[model samples]
Target: MVDHRQRRDELIDVVWRLIVEDGLAGITIRRVAERSGWSSGAVRHYLPTREAILDAAAQRVAELIEERIKAVDASAPPLDALVAVLAAVLPTDEQIQRASLVWLAFVGQAASDAGLADAQGILYRDLNQLLVELLTMLAAMGFQVDGGPASAAVELQAMLDGLTVHVLLGRVDADAAQEVLRAAVNRLLTRPPEADG
Candidate 1:
């Protein structure tokens, strides 16, 4: 009896390795089977199509990042918590760099693939909600924010997304990206909220 969940995770690991070696363009049913040492039929038994495989990979990426974010100390100081949460999303290590590559590829592919787009949407939405919660915590602790928590979260989310790309592009190394994120969160928390127009 196949431990279907375990087998699927094993195949996803192969997909991540392929993604690190080559971009998403490198993935195919045959390549996955060869990489996993499974017959193509067996690989198909789990992920039957290219779209199915990519969708699953995207989901795994989301799950991986969410797990990291969830592991941060929620009881820490609000400012520290904010930085930790945002930093968790950045690809600061080799493993996460691979996931980031896969994530970016699916982001582009998601434009034409409705299923992929939905997965991507859920990822963005969940991350955004987490940010909102952390930002709200800061506000509750009497930190001065430039806007409401929701608006501030949007800005932080965009900044984190851009930083992820820069790190992946080699334009910004991981250390510098982390420094920039920490500084940005500090500024956001200290900056005064905007008055109503």
Candidate 2:
């Protein structure tokens, strides 16, 4: 019996591989069929268009990051867990590197593609909400967030987004990005509350 879910995942994997090798422009129904060794009709049966392929690739990256975030040690020290959550979203490893690049490509194309733009907005909202929850938890655990959890999540999200680009562009390596993220989180967690005027 064909495991439909497994087949879909394999197709998405092929999409990411193609994106890494040739950018988003490299993706096509026929190309995916070739790469996955499936018939073009079969590929179309799963994802009817190039946009669908891009959407799936972007979604897979988000899913991978969320899975990593959920797997972080809840029992670990608060700071470590926080770092692990943020780090889970970074493109620090081979798998994440490929996935992140595909996501970035999709985001870059979103500027001209309304469907992709909508998906991008939803992705940002979901990720932002996740960060807000994490920040709220840290605050409850005795960490101080400089601008409340919502604002802190925005700041952390920006830092994470920038660090991903920097890491991918060779401006900073994975270790450096991790250090930067750690420092940023530490400041957010440990900064003394502002004095009233």
Worst 10 residues of 2 by lDDT: 188-197
**CA displacement after TM-score superposition, residue 121 of candidate 2 (Å):** 3.1
What TM-score would each prediction reach against the true structure? 0.84, 0.88
Instruction: Give lDDT tens digits, candidate 1, residues 1-197.
Output: 86999999999999988876787778899999999999999999999998788878888988989889889997776677778888888888887888888888778778887877886786788889888887786677667777888998999999999999999999998789888888888777773354120
Report lDDT (Cα) of residue 181, candidate 1. 83
Q: Candidate 2 at residue 51, lDDT?
A: 80
What candidate 1 gets wrong by more than 4 Å, as runs, is 191-197
Q: How far in Å is the alpha carbon of 118 misplaced in model 1?
A: 1.9
TM for candidate 2 is 0.88
Question: Candidate 2, overall lDDT?
Answer: 0.84
- lDDT string, candidate 2, 1-197, tens digits: 99998999999989888988888777899999999999999999999998888778878877888888888888776777778888888887888888778778777878998887876776688889988988887777666788999998999899998999999998998888889999998888773354120
Worst 10 residues of 1 by lDDT: 188-197
Best by TM-score: 2
- Report the Cα lDDT for residue 37, model 1: 100
Off by over 4 Å in 2: 191-197
